[model samples]
Target: MSSGHTAVTTALQPCGLPEHRNCGIREVLDRIGDKWSVLVIAELSPGTRRFREIQRGIHGISQRMLTLTLRRLERDGLVLRTAFPTVPVTVTYQLTDRGRSLTHLVQQLADWSLANMAAVAESRRRWDAANPESMIV
Candidate 1:
């Protein structure tokens, strides 16, 4: 409850409907660690986007998850949602500066996933070969 960090903590307290209390950068990490959150961040990292674009970018993400993720990011002030003055009312989502800064970390994780999948697949093959009897399930 110190006076100095109250505002900062209030802003970044990203865990479970964060309060206007003190929280640090580590809190942001915990919030984004969910698989859907990570994937959403990865999908949107490149640039601003419409809902359809985001849906297309992330393979197999249900519409519900994308909507929820965007709302959370917006609440965290990590995302900027712009509504256009158009016939149907177009909406676009982009990272705020804070969110943009996360691009590198997300990209690195995406790279690692690309990398580790092959290793995992190879490992699975080896494991299966050695444990054929366990495959009955």
Candidate 2:
């Protein structure tokens, strides 16, 4: 195993470390650390929302991407998906208890980002100025 993976395994275990081919921490992080998942969870933090409402709330997310994100969140037991038999088959999503727990953390991170945005921007500007060749755009 790579040193990074071994570090994670050791940190996660710390007592009677088991042989882990796959780690639950990595799996959960892979889902929640994605760009859309955190946003989607935060959007649903308010209350239940229809498909269009979620899409509209999160700008720049394509319909297909939103659908996939919602599906993944639902599968992970973070979001509850409810479908109604209507003329257009209406669907709404709300955070489950598990989702609510995760939302609290996401909100805290958002708050921190907003609070330190200027500092972060300044840091980025300095880094970019110092490393012009490393700039992507």
Compare the candidates by lDDT and give the number of the best one.
2
Clashing pairs in 2: none
Q: lDDT by residue for model 1 over 5-77, one digit each (tens)? A: 5455355344345473465656776677777778777777778889999989888888998999889988988
Q: Lowest summed lDDT over 10 consecutive residues: which window, candidate 1?
A: 6-15
Superposed on all Cα atoms, model 2 deviates from the true structure by an RMSD in Å of 5.7
| RMSD versus native structure for model 1 | 10.5
Off by over 4 Å in 2: 1-21
User: How high a TM-score does candidate 1 get?
Assistant: 0.68
- Which candidate comes out best when scored by TM-score? 2
The Cα local distance difference test for each model comes to 0.81, 0.90
Candidate 2 lDDT score at position 80: 97
Collision pairs in model 1: none
Residue-pair clashes per prediction, in order, are 0, 0
